[model samples]
Target: IRAVGTGQDALGEVTIRVREGSRIVQGKGLSTDVIEASARAYVDVLNRLASGHARSSADSAERELAQGGVARP
Candidate 1:
């Protein structure tokens, strides 16, 4: 993560990058408050990770069920 003062209305520009294996995700946030900008950048990465996990888990579950796997109670 990197942040820089944009020198415009006391705003800040933040760049966030996340890497998982061969997958890479990037996000940018700009705000008059530096903290807010940082938080936004972090949340963006977190949301992406959560979304990927949910999708992958669902796909795996479907594959398992299709292969005659049982769903435990």
Candidate 2:
């Protein structure tokens, strides 16, 4: 149903479900602009669940790239 909502209409709602241990976070948004709703849902997920892992991984990657990695002038 959620995929159908996001895929088949210019205006519809989207929901994302994420769970870990006993914790669950769900988000929903509706918009005539599909990108807007998608962004909203993704932001919600990142805020609720994805913040730490993604930031740590991104920081690790940045550190690797900064460590005299191959570079172009």
Candidate 3:
């Protein structure tokens, strides 16, 4: 969730769900200053996604070279 407002005003917050294994991110901006808040939230989700990708790639490579590796069909 990300939000920007003079906050005590009537501005509503924006909420979004981030998906893994895909880069199609999305969002919404409710208040007049929504752009700033939306950008911040997008960046935060992107950073987390980047880190997850790095970890999964490292793990996959390690398994590829592991001893007695499972044979593929």
Candidate 4:
């Protein structure tokens, strides 16, 4: 977790990476509340994994890289 701004209104950003089988999936969230941001990040990863988005997205990225295209995160 990290802060994106300063003072009392600082935005909290959270990033979480989870390992599923042989792949690693990542999720990010930002909010004025650090805990909320963390929860959002965790839920994002869970949704991706549960919906099989992580696997397909990772496969697509690998294919793009193999074809000499940039793999975006």
Best-performing candidate as measured by TM-score? 4
Put the candidates in TM-score order, highest first.
4, 1, 2, 3
TM-score (C-alpha, index-matched) for candidate 1: 0.52
**Across residues 12-59, which tens digit of lDDT does each residue of candidate 1 receive?**
778776666544555667788878888898888788777874234445
Candidate 4 structure quality by residue, lDDT tens digits, 1-73: 8999899999999998787876677889899999999999999999989887775557758977999999876
RMSD per prediction, one decimal?
12.4, 11.2, 11.5, 4.6
Q: Which one wins by TM-score: 1 or 2?
A: 1
Q: Any residue pairs clashing in model 3, and if so which?
A: none
Which ranges of candidate 3 are over 4 A from the true structure? 1-12, 22-32, 53-73
Name the lDDT of candidate 2: 0.58
Number of backbone collisions per candidate: 0, 0, 0, 0
Model 3: per-residue Cα lDDT over 6-71, one tens digit each: 546646456554545533333344554556556656766676566654234335445546855652
TM-score of each: 0.52, 0.42, 0.37, 0.70
Model 3 C-alpha RMSD vs. true structure (Å) is 11.5
Q: What is the lDDT of residue 15 in candidate 2?
A: 78
Candidate 1 segments exceeding 4 Å error: 1-8, 53-73
Against the unseen true structure, what C-alpha lDDT does each candidate score? 0.65, 0.58, 0.51, 0.85
Quote the lDDT for 3 in model 2.
37
